[model samples]
Target: MKIFGYQLGGEKRSGSIENPTVPVSAENFMQFFGVQSGNLPSVTIDSALRVPAIAAAVSFLSGSLANLPLHAFKPKGDGSERIKGGIQKLLNEAPNPEWTSFGWRKYFWQQVFTGGRGVSWIERNGATTAAIWPMDPSTTVVKRVNGRRIYVFDGKSEYPASDVIDVPFLLKKDQISVYSPIMLGSKAISLALAMGDYAGGFFAGGGVPPLALSGPLPAGADAIKRAQSDIRRSIDSAKSNDEAIFPIPPGYKLEAVGFDPQKGQMTEARRFQIEEAGRIYSLPPVFLQDYTHGVKANVEQQDLHLVKHVISQWAKALEEELNLKVFGPRSNGRYAEHNLDALMRGDFKTRMDALSRAVNSALRTPNEARNLENLPAMPNGDTLYIQGATVPLGSQPLLQAPPTGKENDKGNENGDGNDSEA
Candidate 1:
């Protein structure tokens, strides 16, 4: 099968003398077996493949996935034949019976079925019932960068046992401005690029309308153009200073960012912004709105809230969810065994909870209950009474006596009481 001008079982364009130029355009590339280019061929392929790049991307991805020896090698296990048998079970059990891999029969069997989790099924009515093949672990690798473990081929063993981690997927200048600071490493160039692109995309996607530009931007063309310029600059900056950038893991953000060339410290700023009503704001220096707020896309409230919660949780403590079963518990060849150790020590929730507990404990005192009782009522809430030796409730001092006992003394002094002495 061919896709985007690339042939299946074909060699990738490795800048080898045989194929010096990779498919620069998606349209001109040959479509793979049953892999529809859907107007890809009609799109013009610029020198750098502007429009037809999608085809090239698809081709590249297909080529990469194809490189992994799938099904070509026979399993040596005594249960070797079980691989194919396992796949067949998954196909019969999948809810979408018609679902098929694009003309890649091996993919259907190897990548989808009998891949990672292998195959499991239920029997019903004396017949084999529903079954599914989890993704294969032999081809996947996930591990913690902090640890000396480098999990490869389903996390079987740590590579090198060294802490020097390799950042996946090298960065490109134009691609710099897409993700958040947390998504990018603390490299200034990457962060700037991300901010610029996010800002540009917001304007481009109609997130912020031109009419809403408070200043400088004349809306529409002008706003978009400015965003584009900003993103371009950010990308340029990122490429030059790769080391300074910090990569944000799934849910974390830079906090309390600052740079001291002497100390060799450039870290994420931990400061957060308080949104007052609808206005957008930020903590100075560390981060800011990527683009003009009015020009960006307005995110869905639910999604934004969820993302915010996740990011906040990550920023505060990465340990809690580190071991969460986002994938699963079993060793089916995915990430680490529950990172319970990480979560227990580094989870944002755990840290936040600990902090809260400490603060509450500090606020308590020996006479807190009595103090609260004597506290004055206010329009908003109760006020703490701290000054008096003892707290007393009600309108008057606790030491004061009723008028009945003091009437005799008062009458002699005033000469006007009902018990007055001449």
Candidate 2:
């Protein structure tokens, strides 16, 4: 029999069409329960430890048991001794003693795949205590003094002491949502962004929802109008130029050109040209506002891929710009593999500092060196704005300058008195 896609060896499946029920016999019950009725239930499991078959049977008998007289049944001889033995067996099966003493290892850990006290943190006076993961050595869980459901984790070590870090959100319900960059106070939202669930992430990250165009007026109506106007102007210009060069060939009516009224104003000339062009000749209509909007929407929807590509490009540019050797697990389309093995085996603190330095080096700002004195300056009176000396149009400025008496003497000394070459 298949239960939740698992086959049970040698079990008969007999049940109703609407609500299927598994058949159970005294022998099958004993085998399934791991106890014998002959010993009067000597070794029953703990009340906290519930099995499917036992739970279902108890549920089925609850209503029926109420109808039967409670005082009608009598306890068998030494029944109290059997009960004591069962209780002892249950106490023996209660989880490891260290789990109870250390508080981090919770009882319901098997129900979840990710976290427990390993997932806990500490807070003080309604504030997060410190960063409490692999890096942190002393973070603990904080519980409200009198409340049953309130808890807080203070992340002072991971962040500045001033910020209040919300910890309940740090642990995500889904594994895919866990790798995102953590926000200063909003770890949940950051994780959502890293997982590429932008809309969900935005909501989780305390971002406002996008307004839909449900009524006659859209939220970005003004921007859309401006964009559409710009698009129309370009198309109109193209149409006018095309019309001037090639006026509609004689006797061809506009209706015969297959224009749709619902699609708004479109130039017949542009449509004809587009139709004439085959698939390969067709372009992306870069100037069209509607096309641009569609492209932007698609890119925004798949922004993670774009971000990854941009990061890769930046990393490559950084490698070329800075003469530093870089190392990454997934750089240059090759896996780091054992390249990081030594770092993993060595002091993690030193490795972390090295990684930070390398990343910062790659992102260093370019220097702007200049000779300030060589730059042009404004006139003394008009010191507010820098002005370049104006050169007169008619002649070279140096030649046009009013001549001093010394200049004429210098010219005469250079044989400025003209004489034709003999």
Candidate 3:
């Protein structure tokens, strides 16, 4: 978002964040997320994430999903209640001793977004889940063997599909490997990275383009070297003395060589790359902190856009995967769900207003609303309430006058409390 002060680092190291200068294969791209260099840099996940747009998109998505409140639920009567214990703790708290739920899930989704696949093993002690362990998508391979899927980790251990939780950004026809975002969006990402490389080197050289020395140049090779040496010495001397002006040889001049950033349309090109990266994840530009085309309505549409077209789809992908693997085929209607209230924690006033309306309309009990705000329940707050003045759709009006039929006066005279006075 803050483009002017982008903290682009030193030039990319060559022959190693470089590649060993070896050619990498398309098939092995997912295995190692390898990079191949050429006319355009081969986009590996590492290089792709270096682009600010890709980094922002990946971080936003994974971090948002990681913070969601995941809980296991079981059907109770007409609906389902969040069930607590090992499974819930495993999902919402600590998956393994080494990692918290948030940490694991963030890593999981990061892989899903970048490498195009996320995988974990659901460790079990007999029939009960013991702990969950994440696998590196770069090192783990999924393949179908004997008409069943298996996860092979580091080419050694193999896990049955029934015991693995897997989500792919997109599944290939073979269902063994996924189409990596970096590889699939290579053209755009490669351009973004190339721009970064050029920008880094350009700005590092004092934001000045290469200088071309001209005029009265000697034709002989030895003479040209002498002139170049003299020019270098003069420039170095001027710089050392902090002088603003340096003299050139008689009839010589210096001018910047090649196209400047503006001439290259760097700003527009960079902005377009951000939009391109957003498209890879189907994310709205607003979500990527791109406000060039943003307005009030466009910004507000993000919540719906994210939930409907982005977050919910990935969340459902994960939910289905986790459920299928963790609970087996006959899950008995017990499922793990993500509570999306975490996404609406944008600001205090909006959240409070929503909760207030929910409570006043009897959509949620006062205590339930309080629980969302981490507030203690008040006395009798668990009960649902509605406006007392409301009536059934076809019911008689309150405090209505009696009918004017002849029997009405006779009936009232016998039964009404004011009969004697009348």
The global C-alpha lDDT for each of the candidates, from Candidate 1 onward, is 0.31, 0.29, 0.84
190-292: candidate 3 lDDT, tens digit per residue: 9999988989989987576878766662244455556678888888888789887878777767898668999899989999998999999999998888999
Is candidate 1 or 2 superior in TM-score? 1
Candidate 2: segments with Cα more than 4 A from true spot: 1-113, 116-141, 145-166, 169-419
- Model 2: per-residue Cα lDDT over 178-279, one tens digit each: 221112212222222222343344456334233211222222445444544554465466666754332222232122222232243333333332222211
Candidate 3 or 2, higher TM-score: 3
User: Model 2 residue 9 lDDT?
Assistant: 68
What lDDT is reached at residue 173 by model 1? 51
lDDT of 1 by residue, 1-422 (tens): 64533455643543221233434345634343223453222211121122122223223333323222222112354422213433232322231244332223223222211121111112222222232223233354544465533435444533331211121122235432122222222232233333344446545743422221122322344454555555445545665675345333222222322223224321121111111101111111111222223222343342244235422332222112211222123413322111112223335676556544443454433233233235444452333323344445585755866577677777767876664334
**Quick one: RMSD of model 2?**
34.9
- Best-performing candidate as measured by lDDT: 3
The local lDDT score (0 to 100) that residue 132 gets in candidate 1 is 22
TM-score of 1: 0.19
Candidate 3, after superposition: displacement of residue 419 in Å? 17
